[model samples]
Target: MFDIKKITVLGAGAMGNGIAQVSAQAGYQVIMQDITEEALQRGMATIRKSLDKMASKGKIAPEKVEETLSRINTAVDLEEAAKDADLVIEAVPEILDLKIEIYKRLDVVCKPEAIFGSNTSTLPITVLGAATKRPQQVCGIHFMNPVPVMPGVELIKGRLTSDEVMEVAVNYVKSIGREACLAVDYAGFIVSRLLDVVQNEACKLVMEGNAPEEIDKAMKLCANWPIGPCALMDLVGLDIVEHGLGTLENDLGPEYKAAPLLRQMVRAGELGRKTGRGFYEYNK
Candidate 1:
C-alpha cells in the first residue's frame, strides 16, 4: 500500500467541495483547485459550511474544525495544487474528452509515484487510465453524491491499475471513514448499474400516467429507500442521469438505452435541483 497524506482535488463544484471536506476532516492536507478564483472560493465556502455543521452538532470539536479548515488550501492553478500531492482526484464534469485532457496534464505534472483517481460514477477506469503515464497508479474512488453523508466509496481497478494501488486506495478511503467496495471497470460501476435500472423504470412509470410524487412515494415505501427515485433523479440532475444512461448504453448495449423522458427533460435543460426543476421542482 502507498501513503496518502496530501491530496489535490480538481473541480470546485459540489462533489469536489464535498470530497475536500471529507479529506480535510480526515486530517489530510487538501489542495482544492478550480479554473477560476471565484469558483475555488465557492468550493472552500462549501467546505466551511460542512465543517460548521459538524461543529454545531458536536460531531467534531471546535478546535478540530479549525484545524481541518486550516489544512485546506484552495487554488485556481492545477500544477500548483497537484505539486507533491500523494493523491490527486479529478471531480470535473463527466465528459470523456475533458476527463482525458485533465488526466494527460496531471500525468505530466504529478509526481511519478502519486496515485491519481477519479470520482466518476459511470465511466470506465480503464478508459480514463489510458491518458496517464503510470496507469498502474490510477484508479477510481467513486464517492456518492453527498460525499460527507455517504458511507460507501466504490474502488474501481482499471485493467492497468496495480493490485497494490487498489489496496492503498481501499486503505485511504477507510482512513477517511468511508467503506470501499471493489468494482470492475465498466460502463456502470455496481451501484450505477443497479440504481440506473431502478431510476429508469421509475421514469417509465411517470410516462405511463403515474404522477411523479406517486411514483416516488411507492418506491419510497416499497424499497425503504431514503428518498423516492424521482427525488434522487432530481438530486442527481437530469443531465447527469441522461449522460449516465447514454454511457451505459454505449458500453453495455441497447439494454441500457436512455429513457425517453430523461432525454426530454435534459434537452429542455431541466437539470433538477440546480435548475430548480426536474422530475420535481424546488421552491425558490
Candidate 2:
C-alpha cells in the first residue's frame, strides 16, 4: 500500500480549497497551490472561514480549526508543491488541455510512487491518465461541490489505473469521512450526468416561460428535493453547469445539450452566487 501522508492540491479554487481542508483535517500535510499568490491567499482565507464556521457551530473544536489550518500550506509554485507529494489531486478548471499540462508537469516533479488524481466531474479519467508517465497511478477522486459537507465522493478508475491506486483513493476518501462510490471511466461518470440532465431540463423550463422561482419552489415542495434545479444551477455557477452540459452533449449525445437560457446566462456573466446572479440574484 502506498502511504499517502502528504497531498498537493493544484488549483486553489472552491474545490481545491475544500479538498485541502478535508485532507488536513484528516491529518495529512497539505499544500494548496494556484498560479498566483493572490489566489492562494484567497483560497486560504476561504478555508479559514469555513473552519471557523464549523467551530462556531460546534461541529469541530475551536482548537482543531487552527490545528487543521496549520497542516495546510499555500504555494504558487507548482514544482515546489509537487516535489514531495505522496498524492496530487488536480481541481483546476474543466479544461482538458490545461489539466494535461498540469499532469505532464506533475509527472516530472512528483515522486515516481506518487498517485495523480483529477477531480473532474465529466472528463474521461483515461484521457487524463494518458497524459502522465504513471498512468497506472492516475485515477479520479471526484468530490461533490461543497466537499466538506458532501458525504459521498466518486472514485473513478482510468483505463490503466491499478487496483492498488484505486484502493488507496478509497482509503483516503474514507479517512476524510466520505463514502467512496467507485465509477467507471466515462463522461460525467454517474452523479454529474444525472444531475446535469435534470439541471438542463430545468433551464428549458425557464426558456418555455415558466418562472424560475415557481419552478424551484415546486420541485422543493412537491418533489421533496433539497434544492430546486434552477437554484442548484445557480449555486453551481451557470458557467460550470453550462460547461458540464456541453461536455456531456459532446461525449454522450445531443440530449445533453445545454439549454439556450443557460448559455445566455453564462455569456451574460451571471454566474450564480459567486457573481451575484444566475437563476436568481444574490447579495454580493
Candidate 3:
C-alpha cells in the first residue's frame, strides 16, 4: 500500500482551501500553494472560519481545529510546496490550459511516488494526465463544492491511470470521510453532467420569462430539492456554469448549449455568492 502523509494543494481558491482543510483534518501535513499572498491569506481565513464554525457546532473540538490548522502551511512557490508531497491535488480555475500548465510544473517537482489529482468538473482526466510524463499516476479526484459539507467525491481514472493509483485515491477520499464513487473519464463525469442539464434548463426558464424566485420556490416545494436551481447555479458561479455547459455542448450536443441568460450573466460578472449577485442577491 502506498502511504500518503503529506498533501500539496494548488490554488488557494474555495475548492483549494476546502481540500487543504479536509486533508489536514485527516492528519496529513498540507502545503496550500497559490501564486499570490492575498489569495493565500484569503484561503487561510476561509479555513479558519470553517474550523471555527465546526468547533462552535461541537462537530470538532476547538483543540482539533488548532491541530488541523497547524498541519497546513501556505506557500507562494509551487516547486517548493510540491517538493515533498505524497499527493498533489490541483484545484485551480476550471480552465483546461491552466490546469495542464500546473500539472506540467508539478510533474517536474513532485516526488516520484506522488499521485496527481485534478478537481475538474468537466475536463477529461486523460487529457489532463497527458500533460505530464507520469500519466499512470494521474487521476481525477473531483470533490463537490463546499467540500467539507459534501459527503461524496467522484474518483475518475484516466486512460493510463494505474489500479494502484485508483486505490490510493479511494483511500485518500475515505481518509477524509468522503464516499468515493468511481466514474469513467468523460466530459462531465456523472453528477455535473446530470446536474448541469437541470441548471441549464433553469436558466432557459429565466430566459423564457419565468421568474427566478418562482422557479426556485417551485423546485424547492415540488421537487424537494434542498436548494433551487437558480440559487445552486449562483453558488457554483455563473462563469463556471457557462464553461461547463460549453464543454458539454461541444462533447455531448447542442441540447447542452448554455442558455443565453447564463452567458450574459457571466459576461456581466454577476457570479452569484462570490459577487453578491446572480440569479438572486446575497448579503455579502
Candidate 4:
C-alpha cells in the first residue's frame, strides 16, 4: 500500500479544482495543475468562492477556508505538480488520446509507486492503465459533479489494477468524507451508465415536446430523484454528457447514442454553468 500524503490533480477545470479543494480539505496536500497560468488562477478563485460559501453556511469554520487554501498549490508545469504526489487524480477533458498522453507523462514524472486515479465518468480504466508503466497502480476515482458537495465516489478497478490500489482508493475517499463504491472497469461504469441513459431519455423527452423545467420537476417530484435529469445534465455540462454518450455508444451500442438535441446543444457551445448557458442560463 502506498502512503498517500499528497495529491496532484491534472486540469484546473471545474472537476479538477473541486477535487483539489476536497483533497486539501481532507488534510492532504494538493497540487492543481493546468496548462496555463490563467487557468490555475481561475481554479484557485473557484476554490476560494466555494470555501467562502461553505464557511458562510456554517458548514465549516471560517478559519477552515484559509486552512484549506494553505494546503493547496497551483502549477502550470506537469512535472512540478506531480513529481512528489503519492496519488494523482486526473480530471482532464474526456479525450481518450489526451488522457493516454497524460498518463504516459505522469508515469515519467510521478514518483515510483504513486497511484493514478481518473475522475472519469466514461472511458475504460483498463485502456488508461495500459498507457503507463504502472498498470497495477491505475484505478478510477470518479467523483460526482461538484465534487466538494457530492458524497459518493466510484472506485473502479481496471483489469491491471491491484487490490492495494483499490484499497487505497477506498481509504482515500473515506478520508475525504465520501463513500467509494466499487465498480469494474467499463465505459461509463455504474453511475454514468445509469445516469447517462436517464439524461439521454430526458433529452428525448425534451424533443418530444416536454419542457426542460417540467421534465426536471416531474423527476424530482414524481420519482423522488434529487435532481431532474435535464437539470442534472445541464450541471454535468451538455458537451460532457454528449461526449460520454458517444463513448457509451461506441462501447455499448446505438441504444447508448446521444439524443439529437444533446448533440445540437453541444454544437451551439452552450455547455453548462461554466459557460453561463445550457438547459438554463446563469448570470455571469
Candidate 5:
C-alpha cells in the first residue's frame, strides 16, 4: 500500500463531514471541502460536536478532540482542497451527474497518483471510475452513516481499479479503526442494498395500516435488531432511502423500487431527522 498522509473529502453534509472526522481522527491531514463557506463551517461544527460528544462519553480522551480538529482544514475550492492530497473521498449526494462532474474536476486538479474514492452506497463504482482519466485509481469507500461511531466500511473495487489502490484503501480503513468488507461494484453495495430493502418494506407495512411504533417495537423485541427498520429509516432520511431504492430498482429490478408510501413521504418533504419528520417526528 502506498503511504497516504493527506485525504480530501468533497461535500460538507452528513456523510462528508463524518468521513472527514474519522480520517482526521486517524491522524490524516484532511481537507473538508464544499461549495459554500456556510456548508464548510456547518460541517466543521458537526465534527466538533461529534468529537466532543465522544470525549464526554469516555470513548476518547478529551485532548483527542482538539488534536483531531487541528488536522482538518476547510476549503470551498475543489482545486484547492484536492490539489495536494494523496486520497480524495467524494461524499456528495447520490446524484450521478454531480459526482461525475466532481471526478472530472478532480482529474484535472489532483495528482496522478491520488486515489479517488466515492462514499456513494447506491451508485456503481465502475461508472464513477470511468468518468475520469485515471480509472485505475478510482474505487468506492462507502462509509456508513454516523461515521465516527460506525466500525465497518464497505470497500469496492471498480472494474479498472488497481490492486495497489485496493491495498491502500484497506490500509486506510484500518488506520481509521474500521474493518473493510470488499464488495463488487454494484448499485446499493452491501449495507444499503439490504437495509434499504427492509426500510422499503417497512413503508409498505405502514401503508397497510401498521403503526410505525409497533413495527419498530416488534423488530427490536423479537428480531434481535439494535434498531428497528422504521426508526432506522427516520435516522437515514426518508428521501435518501427513496433515492437509494430507485437506484436499486434501476439496476436490479422492479421489485427493488421504493414503496408508494415512501415516495409520498419524500414528496411531502418529511425527510426524517434532517427535516424533522418521517415515520416519526424529531425536534429540529
Candidate 6:
C-alpha cells in the first residue's frame, strides 16, 4: 500500500473543496488548487465553514478543527500543488476532454509513482486511464456529495488498473473514515444507475403535466424516500442528472433519454442550488 502523506486535489469547487476537507480531517496534508485565485479563496472559505460546522456538531474538537483547517494549503499552480503529492485526486469538471487534458498535464508534472485518481461519477475509468502515462496506477475514487456526511465511497477499477493501485485506493478511503465498495468500471455504476432512472422519470412525469411538488410528494410517500425525486435532482444539480442520463444512453440503451424539461432547465442555466434555481430556489 502506498503511504499517503500529502494529497493534492486539482480543483476547488464544491466536490474538490469537500475532498480536501476530508483529506485534511484524515490528517493528510492537503493542497487544494484552482485555476483562479478568486476560486481558491472561495474554496478556502467553504472549508472554514465546513470545519466550523463539524466543531459545532461535536464531530471534531475545536482544536482539531483549527488544526485540520491549517493542514490545507490553497494553491493556484497545479504543478506546485502536485509536485510531491503521494496521491493526486482530480476533482475537475466532468467534461471528457477537459479531464483528459488535466490528466495529461498531471502525468507530466507529478511523480510517476504517485497514484492518480478521478472523482468522476459517470465517465469510464479506463477512458481516464488512457490519458495518463501510468495507466496501471489510475483508478476511480468516486465520493458522494457532502463528503463529510457520506460514509461510503465507490472504488472503481479501470480495465488497466492494477491490484496494487486498487489496494492503495482502498486503504486511502479507509484512512479517511469512509467505507469503500468495489465496482467494475461501468456507466452509472451502482447508485447512479438507480438514481439516474428515478430522477429522469421524475422529470418525465413533470413534463407530462404533474407539478414538481406533487411528483416529489408521490415518490416520497410511495417509495419512502426522504426527499422527492425532483427535490433530490435539484439538490444534486440538473447538469449531473443530465450527464448521468447521457452516460446511461451511451452505455445501456437509448431508452434512457434525458427528460425534455431537464434539458430545457439546464439550457436556461437553472442548475440547482448553486445557481439559486432548479426545482427549488436555494437562498445563500
Per residue, candidate 2 scores C-alpha lDDT tens digits across 1-284 of 88999999999998999999999999999999999999999999999999999999999999999999999998989999999999999999999999999899999999999999999989999989999889999999999979889999999999999999999999999999999999998899999988998998888999999999999899999999999998898888888888888888888789888888888889899899999988788899
Model 3 bad stretches (over 4 Å): 282-284
The per-candidate count of clashes, in order, stands at 0, 0, 0, 0, 0, 0
Candidate 2 local lDDT, residue 49: 94
Q: After superposition, how far is residue 256 of candidate 1 from its true place, in Å?
A: 1.3
Order of quality (lDDT): 3, 2, 5, 4, 6, 1
lDDT of 5 by residue, 20-80 (tens): 9999988999999999999999999999999999999999999999999999999998999
List the candidate 6 regions with Cα displacement exceeding 4 Å. Answer: 268-270, 274-277, 280-284
RMSD per model, one decimal: 1.3, 1.6, 1.7, 2.0, 1.6, 1.9
For model 3, what is the error of residue 95's alpha carbon versus the real structure, in angstroms, after optimal superposition? 1.4
Residue 114 of model 2, lDDT score:
96
Best by lDDT: 3
Clashing pairs in 6: none
Model 4 misplaced stretches (Cα beyond 4 Å): 268-284
Looking at candidate 5, the ten consecutive residues that score lowest on lDDT are: 183-192
TM-score for each predicted model, relative to the true structure: 0.96, 0.94, 0.94, 0.92, 0.94, 0.93
lDDT of 3 by residue, 231-275 (tens): 999988888888898998887789899988888899899999999
Full-model lDDT for every candidate: 0.89, 0.93, 0.93, 0.92, 0.92, 0.90
lDDT of 6 by residue, 83-160 (tens): 999899999988889999988988999887999989998888898899988999999999988887899999999999
lDDT of 4 by residue, 18-125 (tens): 999999999999999999999999999999999999999999999999999999998999998999999999999889999999999999988989999998888999
lDDT of 1 by residue, 1-284 (tens): 56889999999898999999899889899999999999988888888888889889999898887898899898888888998899999999889999999999999998889999999989999999999888898999999878889999999999999999999999999999999999989878899988888888888888898998988888778878889988998988878777888899999899888789888888898888998998887884
Residue 276, model 4: lDDT of 88
- 6: Cα error in model 1, Å: 1.4
- Per-residue error for 133 in candidate 2, Å, reads 1.6
RMSD of 2: 1.6
Clashing residue pairs, backbone N/CA/C < 3 A, model 3: none
